[model samples]
Target: MTLVAFRYWLAGMSLALATLVTPLSTAQAISPLGGPRFAAVLMDADTNEILYAEQATAIRHPASITKVMTLYIVFDALDAGRLRLDDRVVMTPRAVSQRPSKLGIGVGQSLSVEEAISVVAVKSANDVAVALAEKVGGSEENFARLMTAKARQLGMRQTVFANASGLPDPAHFTSAQDIAILSAAMIRHHPDRYRCFSEQSYSYGRLRLANHNKLLGVVPGLDGIKTGFTNDSGFTLTASAIRGGRRLIAVVLGSPSGWQRDRDITTLLNTGFTALDIRRNGGIEDMPALLSSAGFTLNRSLRPVPQLATLDVEEGDGE
Candidate 1:
C-alpha cells in the first residue's frame, strides 16, 4: 500500500488499541520528585495505572513535551479523515520564521505531511511544528486551542497550551503528572502512530537531526516518545518502554542533566517492572525482554550539551 494509505490504516488500527482508557478524576496524581525541581511518574500504559509519582500534580513548564499533544492531534486528524499524510504542508513565512533545531525549511517550501512529521520527530523543528499546527488547526492559535481542549478532555487539570511547538510561552504550562497522562494516551491510544517518536535520526538536506530522548537508544525495549528542553523548562523527557507484557511511561521534568534524565528513566523503569514482576510472580526475576538480548544497549544518549547541566527554569518557577 502507498505510504499515505498505510498511514491512514495504521492510525485507524491504533484507535482499536485504545483499550487503555481512563476516566476523569479530581484527584491529583502522584509525582516522583522529592523536591520542587523534579517531577516524575511511572504509569502503566496498558492499564492506565499510575504505579508511582513524585510532585506529579505540581503545574510546571513541559518544555517540548508539548509535542506529545501535537502528535496526538496529528494522529487524531489522520484518524478522523481530515487530512492525508501525502497532503502538501506548505510552509508559511510564519512557520519558517519560528526558531532553531529545525529542518531549516524555508517559507514557500513544501513537504508532504509524512515528511513534515519526520522533521518534527527527528529534529523537533519548530518550523515543522507550526506547519503541522497550521494544517491541523488552521493557525497556531487555533491549534493551541485544540490542544488545550484535548488536554481538558483527557482530564489534564492544570495544563494549558499557547502554541503547537512548545516554544517558550508564559501561558503554556503543564505539570509532569499531566504529561504522564498525555504520554500514556499516546502509547495506549495511538500505539501505531507513536512509533514515530522512536526514530533515532533523520536528515533534511545536509542537516541531520537525532531524537532528543536518549533512553530509546540505550535502554532496551524503549520503542518511542518525545523529549524537550528550554531556558524556561529545563530538561524534560517523556519516555516509554515495554518489557514482557508490562509497559510504563516515565516522565521526568526539570531534570538537571541528560545523564540524570536517562538515569532517572532507567531507574523508574527498573523499579516499575521490578514491582510488577514481584507482584505477579511473587519475586523479582529477569525481565522477558532482557533475556532476549541483554546488553543490547545502544547509544541512545546523545552527546551531552554543556548547557544541559546548567539549564535554567522559566521565570515562573513556582507559579
Candidate 2:
C-alpha cells in the first residue's frame, strides 16, 4: 500500500482494535481550558499537599501525556515478570502505520520492551504506544481499560483513557490534579522504572530521538515526567522537579505554545519551592505574579469547571 493509504488502514485497524465508535465531531464533548487558556497545579510529592492550583480539577484532553499512564502499565508488567526489556515485540502493520511523532519502525521490525518504553517516553511515538498496548493487554482498547482502572487505583479520580497514544479523542480526558497524582505515583510507587522518564534520548535502529521534556536540562532539579500537545489540547505538560530534598509535581495544560507552557510550569515550581523556603533561585517576591493576575486562584481550593480540551515534532519536540 502507498504510505498514505497504509496510514488510513492502520487507523482503521486501531479503531477496530479499540472497538469504540464516537462521532467524528466528538471534539465538542470537552471544552479546552478557558481564561488564559491554562490549567495548572503544583503539589508536594512527599506530603501530598496542594501548594498552588488553578482549575486543578478542570477536565482537559491529555494529548500524548496519556503515554505516562501507558508507561505505568509497562512498568507494572515488567515488575510482575509478565514482560521483559529484551523480549522483542514484533511490529505489525497496525503499529508500523500509526500517525506521526512516531519512531517509524517498519512492519515486521521488532523492538524490545525497554526500547519501546524509551521511545514512548521521549518521542511520544504513537506507533510504539500501540505496540505496548498490544504487547501487554492484547489490544489498545484493553490496555486503555487497564489504564483507566489503574488510574482509579492510583487516585487519579478524573482520568479516563480512550487510547494508549493520547491522540485527539474527546473522550480521552484528565485533570491537572489527576496528572499530578500520576506523576507522583510514578516516582513514589516505582522508583526503579521512573528513571526512564529522565532519559535524554533513545536510539532505535538509525533513529536517535531526544526527549521532548525541556525542563530536564534547563531547570535545576527538574527531572521528569512528560509533555504533550495536539491542535485541540494545545501545549500541555506534566513535570516533576526536586529541590532541597523535596520533590514537587506540576501539571500545566492548554498553553498557547511550548514556551508558554514551560514558562508557566517553571513559575509554578519556583513559587512552590519559594513557599517552602527551599528555592535556590529566588524568593517569593521574585516569583512571578502571573498566577494571580492571569486568573489562577493560587493558595485556594477551587471547584472543577466543566470539560475542555502536541509539541511541534518538526521543531524537534515530541508530543
Q: After superposition, how far is residue 264 of candidate 1 from its true place, in Å?
A: 0.7
Error of 2 at 17 (Å): 22
Superposed model 2: Cα runs more than 4 Å off: 1-37, 278-318
Clashing pairs in 2: 31-307, 31-308, 31-309, 32-308, 32-309, 229-310, 230-310
Residue-level lDDT tens digits of model 2 in 1-319: 8853553355445444333332333333234333224578889999888877777876777788899899998898899898899998778788777777888768888888888888898888998899889888777877777787677778776677888888877667778899999999999988988988898887877888899888888888998999987766667899899987989998988776787778878878877776777344454442336456544445422333333223335422247
Question: CA lDDT, every prediction?
Answer: 0.71, 0.76
Number of the predicted model whose TM-score against the real structure is largest: 2
What are the root-mean-square deviations of the candidates from the true structure over C-alphas? Answer: 9.8, 8.3
